[model samples]
Target: MLVSEVMLQQTPVTRVLPIWQEWMDRWPTPAALAAEPAGEAVRAWGRLGYPRRALRLYAAAAAITADHDGVVPDSFDGLLTLPGVGTYTAAAVAAFAYGRRATVVDTNIRRVQARVISGSALPAPTLSAAEMRLAAALLPEEGAQSAKWNAAVMELGALVCTARAPKCGNCPIRSECAWLAAGQPAPSYVAKGQPWAGTDRQVRGAVMGVLRATRMPIQRELFFAPVPELGDDGLDGTTFSESLRSQLRRLHSLMAPESQLERAIEGLLQDGLAQSREGGLLLPD
Candidate 1:
């Protein structure tokens, strides 16, 4: 449950399903993961956008093994102390894993609350104290029931009260919805979409891909090669230099600027996801 919650942060359930299953099959316990290199976790993470979560999960596993005797912490506060485990994750693990009553207010739940209780098309960009209070108030007094309600409300928002096009007709409480009662006002704030192509994230993913594809360290020159103006036709593996240059050019064109690439590499190193060794880059040991 903890691993799924962590993986599902920004990624959709469909994307996380196979990866989560594979991860569990590989490392069934925190101790199993802790015994492996942190890089293994990053490699196992595959294309799950936000690779930092992999490193954090590795660190969390090590902490659990060393401090908590390889057992996942049950209490919210205890779970919070784990690396990468934030308020929402801690609360989610507590409620879902241990059957504790937690105010689990994800984006879906927030949207559901906004439309059903506050009469808004969308929630505030950030969670407000009032929203937290309302979420806590809405949770059932009984622990088991509140946990079920938490999941149901989140599902309701995801399936029916979606941010883009809400299916009010299928909504169970559509008639009683505050937004419906108020004639469904448009959102006051304009939500900005995140840029993908040509962004640092794309570049970082490309870099990580190169690292994951090979066990040996990649040369620094290959990492910084500029994008070629034209495609290489005679770039055969027999000519090592030309082939490497051509490959690097292809990678460079897909990546961000050299400075951004360097920054991304540095960030990965700082986050313990990658290592610098002998003028080459490698996944951490």
Candidate 2:
């Protein structure tokens, strides 16, 4: 779960659930994931935005297998040592899996903390020592109960105390919330948002999606391959050739910068998401 959290940062939960299930089912144990080729791990990552997380997860799996006998470590320090396991993930795993009392602060938790404790719409750029101290002060004395409380607070922020428009009336903590008491002061900080369309990231994602959806390797030439020779098209070869060229142009526009796309393609081949075989591109079995 902790590993999944790290991979899923800034990604939508709807997309993360299926990937997480597929990953855990295939690996099941850390040792199982460790035994697979690193390339296989990358291929399994599919269209998750950050490809590097796949590599980190593979490394973390290996560390768990070699050092901890495949059991995910229970201590905060131990979890922190795993690749891609940051402070948030380490604390979350320790609290949730090991029943330790720790403040698991993510965006959701930060929102709740900011609104209720500080009467703000959002928090500082990063979690600070003061924020940690304040959160820790609120943790329940019992370890197990503290974990449950932490989860509850985060869940509330996700479902109700949303960043855009919090439903103050139904909030369990509304009566005591500083922000609510102060009439929900306006957000002091602007939310950082990234555009989606026409970005290289989007194009890269589309390329990966195409690879994953295919059963056989696609040809590098066929990337814009003439519509799979549509059975006896009434239009004939001349018209088809013109259409193919147009389609290729459109696809080229949608892909990454020429050099970047070439590199991404090469990386995919190296990672086993793609393979070059006898003048064709293919997904590995």
Number of the predicted model whose lDDT against the real structure is largest:
1
Candidate 2 on 118-194: residue-level lDDT in tens?
A: 99988887788888888888889999999998899889999999978789889987889998889878988787878
Per-residue error at 232 for model 1, in Å? 12
Alpha-carbon local distance difference test for all models: 0.85, 0.75
The true-versus-predicted C-alpha distance at residue 101 of model 1, in Å, is: 1.0
Question: Residue pairs in steric clash, candidate 1?
Answer: none
Q: Candidate 1: lDDT over CA atoms?
A: 0.85
- State the lDDT of candidate 1 residue by residue for 1-285, as single tens digits: 989999999899999999999999999999999999988999999888899899999999999999999999999899999999998899899999999988898999999999999899999999999999999999999989988998999999888899999999888998899998998899989999899887777777777877876666777666775555324421222223453444455567775677888887887788787898877898988
What ranges in model 1 sit over 4 Å off? Answer: 226-250
Every model: Cα RMSD to truth: 3.4, 5.5
Residue 232 error, candidate 2, Å: 12
Q: Can you tell me which runs of candidate 2 are displaced by over 4 Å?
A: 210-256, 260-285
Top candidate when judged by TM-score against the true structure: 1
Count of clashes in candidate 2: 5
